[model samples]
Target: MRMRLLVVGLLVAFMALTGCAKNQMSTEPGTQAGENAAVATDSQNSNGLSEQDLADQQRQAMAAAEQEITQNRIYFGFDKFDLDAEAKDVLKTKAEALKAHSEWKMLIEGHCDNRGTEEYNLALGERRARAAYEFLVMLGVPSSNLKIVSFGEERPAVDADNEAAWAKNRRDEFKLFK
Candidate 1:
Protein backbone atom coordinates (compact mmCIF):
# COMPACT_ATOMS: atom_id res chain seq x y z
CA MET A 1 0.00 0.00 0.00
CA ARG A 2 2.89 2.38 0.76
CA MET A 3 4.51 1.62 -2.62
CA ARG A 4 1.25 2.49 -4.45
CA LEU A 5 0.96 5.81 -2.58
CA LEU A 6 4.57 6.78 -3.49
CA VAL A 7 3.98 6.01 -7.17
CA VAL A 8 0.80 8.16 -7.25
CA GLY A 9 2.62 11.08 -5.62
CA LEU A 10 5.48 10.92 -8.19
CA LEU A 11 2.98 10.87 -11.06
CA VAL A 12 1.18 13.98 -9.77
CA ALA A 13 4.47 15.90 -9.38
CA PHE A 14 5.58 15.00 -12.90
CA MET A 15 2.24 16.19 -14.36
CA ALA A 16 2.42 19.51 -12.53
CA LEU A 17 5.98 20.21 -13.72
CA THR A 18 5.07 19.36 -17.30
CA GLY A 19 2.07 21.70 -17.21
CA CYS A 20 4.23 24.63 -16.04
CA ALA A 21 6.90 23.90 -18.64
CA LYS A 22 4.29 23.85 -21.38
CA ASN A 23 2.97 27.26 -20.39
CA GLN A 24 6.43 28.84 -20.28
CA MET A 25 7.53 27.38 -23.60
CA SER A 26 4.33 28.42 -25.38
CA THR A 27 4.62 32.12 -24.47
CA GLU A 28 7.16 32.94 -27.21
CA PRO A 29 6.42 35.84 -29.56
CA GLY A 30 4.76 35.32 -33.02
CA THR A 31 2.68 32.48 -31.57
CA GLN A 32 -1.12 32.72 -31.58
CA ALA A 33 -1.26 32.09 -27.84
CA GLY A 34 1.25 34.90 -27.25
CA GLU A 35 -0.83 37.27 -29.35
CA ASN A 36 -3.91 36.35 -27.37
CA ALA A 37 -2.03 36.98 -24.12
CA ALA A 38 -1.07 40.45 -25.30
CA VAL A 39 -4.65 41.23 -26.21
CA ALA A 40 -5.80 40.07 -22.79
CA THR A 41 -3.28 42.32 -21.11
CA ASP A 42 -4.54 45.32 -23.16
CA SER A 43 -8.09 44.94 -21.88
CA GLN A 44 -9.45 47.82 -19.80
CA ASN A 45 -8.08 48.03 -16.28
CA SER A 46 -9.94 49.49 -13.27
CA ASN A 47 -9.16 52.97 -14.55
CA GLY A 48 -10.78 52.17 -17.88
CA LEU A 49 -7.53 52.71 -19.75
CA SER A 50 -5.24 49.92 -20.80
CA GLU A 51 -1.59 50.39 -19.81
CA GLN A 52 -0.43 50.56 -23.44
CA ASP A 53 -3.31 52.82 -24.48
CA LEU A 54 -2.64 55.24 -21.68
CA ALA A 55 1.07 55.43 -22.54
CA ASP A 56 0.32 56.18 -26.20
CA GLN A 57 -2.13 58.91 -25.29
CA GLN A 58 0.39 60.52 -22.97
CA ARG A 59 3.09 60.50 -25.65
CA GLN A 60 0.77 62.12 -28.20
CA ALA A 61 -0.34 64.81 -25.79
CA MET A 62 3.24 65.73 -24.90
CA ALA A 63 4.23 65.96 -28.55
CA ALA A 64 1.34 68.27 -29.37
CA ALA A 65 2.05 70.51 -26.38
CA GLU A 66 5.74 70.77 -27.19
CA GLN A 67 4.98 71.72 -30.75
CA GLU A 68 2.60 74.41 -29.64
CA ILE A 69 5.18 75.99 -27.36
CA THR A 70 7.94 75.84 -29.94
CA GLN A 71 5.80 77.54 -32.58
CA ASN A 72 5.07 80.65 -30.51
CA ARG A 73 7.61 83.28 -29.42
CA ILE A 74 7.48 87.03 -28.58
CA TYR A 75 10.16 89.46 -29.65
CA PHE A 76 11.13 92.57 -27.68
CA GLY A 77 12.29 95.99 -28.87
CA PHE A 78 15.81 97.32 -28.33
CA ASP A 79 16.38 97.82 -24.58
CA LYS A 80 12.64 97.68 -24.01
CA PHE A 81 10.50 95.31 -21.91
CA ASP A 82 7.15 96.50 -23.23
CA LEU A 83 4.93 94.34 -25.41
CA ASP A 84 4.24 95.87 -28.81
CA ALA A 85 1.27 95.16 -31.03
CA GLU A 86 2.91 92.16 -32.67
CA ALA A 87 3.88 90.70 -29.32
CA LYS A 88 0.36 91.15 -28.01
CA ASP A 89 -1.06 89.32 -31.03
CA VAL A 90 1.31 86.42 -30.52
CA LEU A 91 0.49 86.32 -26.83
CA LYS A 92 -3.21 86.22 -27.57
CA THR A 93 -2.76 83.11 -29.67
CA LYS A 94 -0.53 81.54 -27.07
CA ALA A 95 -3.01 82.43 -24.31
CA GLU A 96 -5.78 80.70 -26.19
CA ALA A 97 -3.71 77.57 -26.58
CA LEU A 98 -2.77 77.57 -22.92
CA LYS A 99 -6.39 77.98 -21.93
CA ALA A 100 -7.40 75.00 -24.00
CA HIS A 101 -4.72 72.79 -22.47
CA SER A 102 -4.77 73.50 -18.78
CA GLU A 103 -2.41 70.67 -17.96
CA TRP A 104 0.62 72.39 -19.45
CA LYS A 105 3.10 74.48 -17.49
CA MET A 106 5.52 76.91 -19.12
CA LEU A 107 8.75 78.79 -18.46
CA ILE A 108 9.06 82.27 -19.91
CA GLU A 109 12.73 83.07 -20.57
CA GLY A 110 13.74 86.71 -20.99
CA HIS A 111 16.74 87.45 -23.18
CA CYS A 112 18.55 90.61 -24.35
CA ASP A 113 20.86 91.89 -27.05
CA ASN A 114 24.58 92.18 -26.37
CA ARG A 115 24.42 95.98 -26.08
CA GLY A 116 24.07 96.50 -22.33
CA THR A 117 26.30 95.73 -19.34
CA GLU A 118 25.85 92.25 -17.82
CA GLU A 119 24.04 93.55 -14.72
CA TYR A 120 21.83 95.90 -16.69
CA ASN A 121 20.97 93.29 -19.30
CA LEU A 122 20.02 90.80 -16.59
CA ALA A 123 17.63 93.33 -15.06
CA LEU A 124 16.16 94.14 -18.46
CA GLY A 125 15.70 90.49 -19.22
CA GLU A 126 13.92 89.98 -15.94
CA ARG A 127 11.55 92.81 -16.69
CA ARG A 128 10.88 91.45 -20.16
CA ALA A 129 10.08 87.99 -18.80
CA ARG A 130 7.89 89.54 -16.10
CA ALA A 131 6.02 91.54 -18.71
CA ALA A 132 5.27 88.42 -20.69
CA TYR A 133 4.19 86.61 -17.54
CA GLU A 134 1.87 89.42 -16.48
CA PHE A 135 0.35 89.73 -19.93
CA LEU A 136 -0.38 86.01 -20.04
CA VAL A 137 -2.01 86.21 -16.61
CA MET A 138 -4.17 89.09 -17.80
CA LEU A 139 -5.19 87.03 -20.82
CA GLY A 140 -6.64 84.35 -18.48
CA VAL A 141 -3.63 82.05 -18.16
CA PRO A 142 -3.12 81.04 -14.57
CA SER A 143 -0.01 82.61 -13.05
CA SER A 144 0.74 79.37 -11.22
CA ASN A 145 1.21 77.58 -14.51
CA LEU A 146 4.01 79.90 -15.64
CA LYS A 147 7.53 80.69 -14.45
CA ILE A 148 9.99 83.46 -15.45
CA VAL A 149 13.72 83.27 -16.04
CA SER A 150 16.24 85.83 -17.30
CA PHE A 151 19.15 84.63 -19.41
CA GLY A 152 20.41 88.19 -19.87
CA GLU A 153 22.87 88.57 -22.75
CA GLU A 154 24.59 85.31 -22.05
CA ARG A 155 22.58 83.33 -24.60
CA PRO A 156 22.05 85.10 -27.92
CA ALA A 157 19.59 83.75 -30.45
CA VAL A 158 21.98 84.86 -33.18
CA ASP A 159 25.65 85.50 -32.60
CA ALA A 160 26.20 88.19 -35.25
CA ASP A 161 26.56 91.80 -34.09
CA ASN A 162 24.14 93.11 -36.73
CA GLU A 163 20.67 94.59 -36.28
CA ALA A 164 19.02 91.37 -37.40
CA ALA A 165 20.95 89.39 -34.82
CA TRP A 166 20.16 91.94 -32.11
CA ALA A 167 16.49 91.75 -32.94
CA LYS A 168 16.51 87.99 -32.61
CA ASN A 169 18.43 88.09 -29.34
CA ARG A 170 15.98 90.49 -27.71
CA ARG A 171 13.09 88.05 -27.30
CA ASP A 172 11.08 86.04 -24.84
CA GLU A 173 11.19 82.29 -25.35
CA PHE A 174 8.67 79.75 -24.12
CA LYS A 175 9.55 76.35 -22.78
CA LEU A 176 7.27 73.57 -21.60
CA PHE A 177 7.41 71.69 -18.34
CA LYS A 178 5.34 68.93 -16.86
Candidate 2:
Protein backbone atom coordinates (compact mmCIF):
# COMPACT_ATOMS: atom_id res chain seq x y z
CA MET A 1 0.00 0.00 0.00
CA ARG A 2 2.89 2.38 0.71
CA MET A 3 4.42 1.63 -2.65
CA ARG A 4 1.17 2.35 -4.42
CA LEU A 5 0.73 5.63 -2.54
CA LEU A 6 4.28 6.77 -3.41
CA VAL A 7 3.67 6.08 -7.13
CA VAL A 8 0.42 8.06 -7.02
CA GLY A 9 2.12 11.05 -5.43
CA LEU A 10 4.89 11.07 -8.06
CA LEU A 11 2.30 10.88 -10.85
CA VAL A 12 0.35 13.83 -9.42
CA ALA A 13 3.54 15.91 -9.19
CA PHE A 14 4.49 15.09 -12.76
CA MET A 15 1.02 16.07 -14.01
CA ALA A 16 1.17 19.36 -12.14
CA LEU A 17 4.57 20.23 -13.61
CA THR A 18 3.39 19.35 -17.13
CA GLY A 19 0.32 21.56 -16.69
CA CYS A 20 2.45 24.54 -15.77
CA ALA A 21 4.78 23.93 -18.72
CA LYS A 22 1.82 23.78 -21.11
CA ASN A 23 0.43 27.04 -19.82
CA GLN A 24 3.83 28.74 -20.33
CA MET A 25 4.27 27.28 -23.83
CA SER A 26 0.84 28.44 -25.00
CA THR A 27 1.69 32.08 -24.27
CA GLU A 28 4.83 32.04 -26.42
CA PRO A 29 4.54 34.00 -29.69
CA GLY A 30 4.99 31.15 -32.20
CA THR A 31 2.69 28.79 -30.24
CA GLN A 32 -0.40 30.98 -30.76
CA ALA A 33 -3.18 29.84 -33.11
CA GLY A 34 -2.28 32.30 -35.91
CA GLU A 35 0.95 33.94 -37.03
CA ASN A 36 -0.73 37.38 -36.85
CA ALA A 37 -1.65 36.88 -33.21
CA ALA A 38 1.68 38.44 -32.20
CA VAL A 39 1.08 41.56 -34.21
CA ALA A 40 -0.73 44.51 -32.62
CA THR A 41 -2.98 46.17 -35.24
CA ASP A 42 -5.09 48.37 -32.97
CA SER A 43 -4.24 52.05 -32.84
CA GLN A 44 -4.26 51.81 -29.08
CA ASN A 45 -3.36 48.82 -26.96
CA SER A 46 -5.36 48.03 -23.80
CA ASN A 47 -2.97 50.31 -21.91
CA GLY A 48 -4.09 53.21 -24.16
CA LEU A 49 -0.67 53.65 -25.76
CA SER A 50 -0.24 52.77 -29.42
CA GLU A 51 2.93 50.94 -30.49
CA GLN A 52 4.42 54.13 -31.94
CA ASP A 53 3.37 56.19 -28.98
CA LEU A 54 4.85 53.65 -26.58
CA ALA A 55 8.13 53.65 -28.49
CA ASP A 56 8.26 57.44 -28.43
CA GLN A 57 7.63 57.52 -24.71
CA GLN A 58 10.41 54.97 -24.12
CA ARG A 59 12.87 57.05 -26.12
CA GLN A 60 11.93 60.19 -24.24
CA ALA A 61 12.37 58.45 -20.92
CA MET A 62 15.80 57.19 -21.92
CA ALA A 63 16.90 60.62 -23.05
CA ALA A 64 15.67 62.18 -19.85
CA ALA A 65 17.50 59.59 -17.78
CA GLU A 66 20.74 60.22 -19.61
CA GLN A 67 20.38 63.97 -19.20
CA GLU A 68 19.73 63.62 -15.51
CA ILE A 69 22.74 61.42 -15.04
CA THR A 70 25.14 63.66 -16.94
CA GLN A 71 23.94 67.26 -16.90
CA ASN A 72 20.99 67.89 -14.62
CA ARG A 73 22.99 70.13 -12.27
CA ILE A 74 24.07 73.77 -12.33
CA TYR A 75 26.96 74.50 -9.99
CA PHE A 76 27.21 77.70 -7.99
CA GLY A 77 30.01 79.77 -6.51
CA PHE A 78 30.29 80.02 -2.74
CA ASP A 79 27.57 82.27 -1.33
CA LYS A 80 26.39 83.13 -4.85
CA PHE A 81 23.14 82.29 -6.65
CA ASP A 82 23.88 83.77 -10.07
CA LEU A 83 24.07 81.54 -13.13
CA ASP A 84 27.40 81.50 -14.95
CA ALA A 85 27.54 81.18 -18.76
CA GLU A 86 27.92 77.39 -18.57
CA ALA A 87 25.01 77.13 -16.17
CA LYS A 88 22.83 79.14 -18.51
CA ASP A 89 23.71 76.83 -21.40
CA VAL A 90 22.80 73.80 -19.36
CA LEU A 91 19.48 75.35 -18.44
CA LYS A 92 18.76 76.11 -22.10
CA THR A 93 19.10 72.47 -23.02
CA LYS A 94 16.98 71.41 -20.07
CA ALA A 95 14.32 73.96 -21.00
CA GLU A 96 14.17 72.64 -24.56
CA ALA A 97 13.68 69.11 -23.28
CA LEU A 98 10.93 70.32 -20.95
CA LYS A 99 9.21 72.02 -23.87
CA ALA A 100 9.33 68.84 -25.93
CA HIS A 101 7.62 66.81 -23.25
CA SER A 102 4.71 68.86 -22.07
CA GLU A 103 3.42 66.15 -19.77
CA TRP A 104 6.55 66.13 -17.63
CA LYS A 105 7.19 68.31 -14.56
CA MET A 106 10.44 69.21 -12.85
CA LEU A 107 11.61 69.79 -9.28
CA ILE A 108 14.65 72.00 -8.86
CA GLU A 109 16.45 71.35 -5.60
CA GLY A 110 18.94 73.87 -4.31
CA HIS A 111 21.82 72.56 -2.22
CA CYS A 112 24.82 74.22 -0.53
CA ASP A 113 28.19 73.26 0.85
CA ASN A 114 28.76 72.81 4.59
CA ARG A 115 30.53 76.15 5.03
CA GLY A 116 27.80 78.31 6.52
CA THR A 117 25.29 78.40 9.36
CA GLU A 118 22.26 76.13 8.86
CA GLU A 119 19.86 79.04 8.59
CA TYR A 120 22.08 81.02 6.24
CA ASN A 121 22.73 77.99 4.00
CA LEU A 122 19.03 77.26 3.84
CA ALA A 123 18.25 80.78 2.65
CA LEU A 124 21.09 80.73 0.12
CA GLY A 125 19.96 77.36 -1.20
CA GLU A 126 16.52 78.78 -1.79
CA ARG A 127 18.01 81.63 -3.74
CA ARG A 128 20.03 79.22 -5.88
CA ALA A 129 16.96 77.11 -6.62
CA ARG A 130 14.91 80.15 -7.45
CA ALA A 131 17.60 81.38 -9.84
CA ALA A 132 17.44 78.13 -11.80
CA TYR A 133 13.66 78.18 -11.79
CA GLU A 134 13.56 81.73 -13.13
CA PHE A 135 16.14 80.92 -15.79
CA LEU A 136 14.08 77.98 -17.05
CA VAL A 137 11.01 80.17 -17.18
CA MET A 138 12.93 82.76 -19.21
CA LEU A 139 14.00 80.01 -21.60
CA GLY A 140 10.34 79.26 -22.43
CA VAL A 141 9.66 76.33 -20.13
CA PRO A 142 6.22 76.70 -18.59
CA SER A 143 6.29 78.09 -15.05
CA SER A 144 3.54 75.71 -13.95
CA ASN A 145 5.73 72.69 -14.66
CA LEU A 146 8.59 73.75 -12.36
CA LYS A 147 8.81 73.55 -8.58
CA ILE A 148 11.67 74.53 -6.26
CA VAL A 149 12.98 73.39 -2.88
CA SER A 150 16.08 73.96 -0.79
CA PHE A 151 18.07 71.30 0.98
CA GLY A 152 20.61 73.80 2.30
CA GLU A 153 23.73 72.16 3.72
CA GLU A 154 21.90 69.18 5.10
CA ARG A 155 22.37 66.91 2.07
CA PRO A 156 25.95 67.11 0.86
CA ALA A 157 26.87 65.51 -2.46
CA VAL A 158 30.31 65.00 -0.94
CA ASP A 159 31.32 65.02 2.74
CA ALA A 160 34.95 66.12 2.42
CA ASP A 161 36.18 69.56 3.42
CA ASN A 162 38.18 70.14 0.24
CA GLU A 163 37.26 72.59 -2.52
CA ALA A 164 36.34 69.80 -4.94
CA ALA A 165 33.82 68.35 -2.50
CA TRP A 166 32.48 71.77 -1.66
CA ALA A 167 32.06 72.55 -5.37
CA LYS A 168 30.18 69.32 -5.91
CA ASN A 169 27.82 70.08 -3.06
CA ARG A 170 26.95 73.62 -4.19
CA ARG A 171 24.53 73.12 -7.02
CA ASP A 172 20.93 72.78 -8.12
CA GLU A 173 19.70 69.32 -9.06
CA PHE A 174 16.78 68.60 -11.34
CA LYS A 175 14.31 65.80 -10.73
CA LEU A 176 11.62 64.81 -13.18
CA PHE A 177 8.02 63.89 -12.41
CA LYS A 178 5.24 62.84 -14.67
Candidate 3:
Protein backbone atom coordinates (compact mmCIF):
# COMPACT_ATOMS: atom_id res chain seq x y z
CA MET A 1 0.00 0.00 0.00
CA ARG A 2 2.84 2.39 0.76
CA MET A 3 4.47 1.65 -2.57
CA ARG A 4 1.15 2.25 -4.39
CA LEU A 5 0.72 5.57 -2.61
CA LEU A 6 4.29 6.58 -3.57
CA VAL A 7 3.57 5.81 -7.23
CA VAL A 8 0.31 7.77 -7.16
CA GLY A 9 2.06 10.73 -5.54
CA LEU A 10 4.77 10.66 -8.16
CA LEU A 11 2.15 10.53 -10.94
CA VAL A 12 0.30 13.52 -9.46
CA ALA A 13 3.53 15.53 -9.17
CA PHE A 14 4.47 14.67 -12.73
CA MET A 15 1.03 15.78 -13.95
CA ALA A 16 1.31 19.07 -12.07
CA LEU A 17 4.75 19.74 -13.59
CA THR A 18 3.44 18.87 -17.04
CA GLY A 19 0.50 21.25 -16.62
CA CYS A 20 2.85 24.08 -15.51
CA ALA A 21 5.12 23.47 -18.49
CA LYS A 22 2.11 23.61 -20.83
CA ASN A 23 0.97 26.88 -19.27
CA GLN A 24 4.46 28.32 -19.62
CA MET A 25 4.57 27.37 -23.28
CA SER A 26 1.22 28.98 -23.91
CA THR A 27 2.46 32.20 -22.29
CA GLU A 28 5.76 32.25 -24.17
CA PRO A 29 6.39 34.93 -26.81
CA GLY A 30 5.71 33.96 -30.47
CA THR A 31 3.91 30.76 -29.45
CA GLN A 32 2.29 28.69 -32.18
CA ALA A 33 -0.75 28.16 -29.95
CA GLY A 34 -1.90 31.76 -30.43
CA GLU A 35 -1.36 31.53 -34.15
CA ASN A 36 -3.31 28.29 -34.30
CA ALA A 37 -6.16 29.86 -32.35
CA ALA A 38 -6.26 32.84 -34.70
CA VAL A 39 -6.36 30.50 -37.67
CA ALA A 40 -9.20 28.57 -36.06
CA THR A 41 -11.22 31.77 -35.53
CA ASP A 42 -10.83 32.71 -39.18
CA SER A 43 -13.64 32.27 -41.69
CA GLN A 44 -11.99 29.22 -43.27
CA ASN A 45 -11.61 26.10 -41.12
CA SER A 46 -8.91 23.44 -41.29
CA ASN A 47 -11.35 21.28 -43.25
CA GLY A 48 -11.13 23.91 -46.04
CA LEU A 49 -14.79 24.83 -45.56
CA SER A 50 -15.66 28.51 -45.33
CA GLU A 51 -17.94 29.85 -42.57
CA GLN A 52 -20.85 30.09 -45.05
CA ASP A 53 -20.37 26.47 -46.08
CA LEU A 54 -20.28 25.32 -42.47
CA ALA A 55 -23.46 27.22 -41.77
CA ASP A 56 -25.17 25.66 -44.77
CA GLN A 57 -24.08 22.20 -43.67
CA GLN A 58 -25.38 22.83 -40.18
CA ARG A 59 -28.73 23.98 -41.57
CA GLN A 60 -28.99 20.88 -43.77
CA ALA A 61 -28.23 18.56 -40.86
CA MET A 62 -30.86 20.26 -38.71
CA ALA A 63 -33.37 19.94 -41.51
CA ALA A 64 -32.72 16.22 -41.91
CA ALA A 65 -32.98 15.78 -38.17
CA GLU A 66 -36.32 17.56 -38.19
CA GLN A 67 -37.67 14.99 -40.60
CA GLU A 68 -36.03 12.08 -38.79
CA ILE A 69 -37.60 13.02 -35.45
CA THR A 70 -40.97 12.01 -36.86
CA GLN A 71 -39.74 8.45 -36.46
CA ASN A 72 -39.36 9.13 -32.75
CA ARG A 73 -42.16 7.06 -31.29
CA ILE A 74 -41.00 4.27 -28.99
CA TYR A 75 -43.33 1.30 -28.63
CA PHE A 76 -43.24 -1.21 -25.79
CA GLY A 77 -44.90 -4.50 -24.93
CA PHE A 78 -47.96 -4.56 -22.73
CA ASP A 79 -47.29 -3.58 -19.10
CA LYS A 80 -43.61 -3.12 -19.85
CA PHE A 81 -41.53 0.02 -19.51
CA ASP A 82 -38.38 -1.51 -20.97
CA LEU A 83 -37.06 -0.20 -24.25
CA ASP A 84 -36.60 -2.71 -27.02
CA ALA A 85 -33.75 -2.67 -29.54
CA GLU A 86 -35.75 -0.77 -32.15
CA ALA A 87 -36.83 1.76 -29.57
CA LYS A 88 -33.22 2.25 -28.53
CA ASP A 89 -32.18 2.89 -32.13
CA VAL A 90 -34.93 5.45 -32.47
CA LEU A 91 -33.77 7.09 -29.24
CA LYS A 92 -30.16 7.16 -30.41
CA THR A 93 -31.25 9.22 -33.39
CA LYS A 94 -33.31 11.43 -31.14
CA ALA A 95 -30.33 11.98 -28.89
CA GLU A 96 -28.18 13.03 -31.85
CA ALA A 97 -30.81 15.48 -32.97
CA LEU A 98 -31.19 16.84 -29.47
CA LYS A 99 -27.47 17.30 -29.16
CA ALA A 100 -27.26 18.89 -32.58
CA HIS A 101 -29.71 21.64 -31.64
CA SER A 102 -28.69 22.95 -28.26
CA GLU A 103 -31.72 25.21 -27.91
CA TRP A 104 -34.27 22.46 -28.60
CA LYS A 105 -36.24 20.61 -25.91
CA MET A 106 -38.10 17.34 -26.02
CA LEU A 107 -41.33 16.14 -24.47
CA ILE A 108 -41.75 12.43 -23.87
CA GLU A 109 -45.41 11.49 -23.60
CA GLY A 110 -46.26 8.11 -22.11
CA HIS A 111 -49.52 6.39 -22.92
CA CYS A 112 -51.23 3.12 -22.04
CA ASP A 113 -54.18 1.03 -23.20
CA ASN A 114 -57.71 1.46 -21.85
CA ARG A 115 -57.48 -1.66 -19.72
CA GLY A 116 -55.94 -0.78 -16.36
CA THR A 117 -57.51 1.41 -13.66
CA GLU A 118 -57.04 5.14 -14.06
CA GLU A 119 -54.57 5.60 -11.21
CA TYR A 120 -52.60 2.47 -12.02
CA ASN A 121 -52.41 3.35 -15.67
CA LEU A 122 -51.25 6.84 -14.85
CA ALA A 123 -48.49 5.49 -12.61
CA LEU A 124 -47.48 2.98 -15.25
CA GLY A 125 -47.46 5.67 -17.89
CA GLU A 126 -45.18 7.78 -15.76
CA ARG A 127 -42.83 4.86 -15.38
CA ARG A 128 -42.76 4.41 -19.12
CA ALA A 129 -41.94 8.07 -19.69
CA ARG A 130 -39.32 7.98 -16.97
CA ALA A 131 -37.75 4.98 -18.61
CA ALA A 132 -37.44 6.81 -21.90
CA TYR A 133 -36.30 9.97 -20.14
CA GLU A 134 -33.58 8.08 -18.30
CA PHE A 135 -32.48 6.43 -21.51
CA LEU A 136 -32.29 9.77 -23.28
CA VAL A 137 -30.26 11.25 -20.43
CA MET A 138 -27.98 8.25 -20.62
CA LEU A 139 -27.50 8.97 -24.32
CA GLY A 140 -26.19 12.45 -23.39
CA VAL A 141 -29.34 14.49 -23.90
CA PRO A 142 -29.69 17.11 -21.17
CA SER A 143 -32.40 16.36 -18.57
CA SER A 144 -33.30 20.05 -18.30
CA ASN A 145 -34.26 19.94 -22.00
CA LEU A 146 -36.69 17.11 -21.41
CA LYS A 147 -40.21 17.00 -19.97
CA ILE A 148 -42.43 13.98 -19.36
CA VAL A 149 -46.21 13.61 -19.43
CA SER A 150 -48.42 10.65 -18.66
CA PHE A 151 -51.66 10.52 -20.57
CA GLY A 152 -52.50 7.00 -19.38
CA GLU A 153 -55.59 5.82 -21.23
CA GLU A 154 -56.79 9.34 -21.78
CA ARG A 155 -55.43 9.34 -25.32
CA PRO A 156 -55.44 6.15 -27.36
CA ALA A 157 -53.68 5.96 -30.70
CA VAL A 158 -56.36 3.54 -31.77
CA ASP A 159 -59.84 3.24 -30.23
CA ALA A 160 -60.22 -0.50 -30.76
CA ASP A 161 -60.15 -2.91 -27.79
CA ASN A 162 -58.05 -5.47 -29.66
CA GLU A 163 -54.48 -6.46 -28.85
CA ALA A 164 -53.16 -4.65 -31.91
CA ALA A 165 -54.65 -1.39 -30.76
CA TRP A 166 -53.32 -1.93 -27.26
CA ALA A 167 -49.89 -2.65 -28.65
CA LYS A 168 -49.97 0.63 -30.53
CA ASN A 169 -51.24 2.45 -27.43
CA ARG A 170 -48.42 1.21 -25.16
CA ARG A 171 -45.95 3.75 -26.41
CA ASP A 172 -43.88 6.82 -25.66
CA GLU A 173 -44.16 9.60 -28.17
CA PHE A 174 -41.62 12.39 -28.72
CA LYS A 175 -42.35 16.04 -29.42
CA LEU A 176 -39.86 18.79 -30.03
CA PHE A 177 -39.75 22.29 -28.56
CA LYS A 178 -37.55 25.04 -29.79
- C-alpha TM-scores of all predictions: 0.64, 0.65, 0.67
Check candidate 1 and list the clashing pairs: none
In model 2, the Cα lDDT at residue 36 comes to 45
Candidate 3 local lDDT, residue 38: 62
Residue 96's lDDT in candidate 3: 89
Model 2 shows how many backbone clashes? 0
Clash pairs of candidate 2?
none
lDDT leader: 1
Superposed by TM-score, candidate 1 places the C-alpha of residue 65 at a distance from the truth, in angstroms, of 4.5
Q: Which digits, one per residue and each the tens of the lDDT, describe model 3 over residues 1-178?
A: 9999999999999988777653653633477876766665783577788788899999998878977765558898988999989999999988888898879888889999999899999998999999999998999999999999999999999999999999999999888876
Instruction: Give candidate 3 misplaced runs (Cα > 4 Å).
Output: 1-58
Q: What is the lDDT of residue 48 in candidate 2?
A: 74
Model 2, span 1-178: residue lDDT tens? 9999999999999988777654553445575533445554462387777788899999988787548534668999989999999999888888877887777889899999999899999999999999999999988889999999999999999999999999999999988866
The residue ranges of model 2 lying beyond 4 angstroms of the native Cα positions read: 1-71
In the predicted model 3, the residue pairs found to clash are: none
Q: Model 2: which ten-residue window has the lowest total lDDT? A: 35-44
Q: Select the stronger candidate by lDDT from 1 and 2.
A: 1
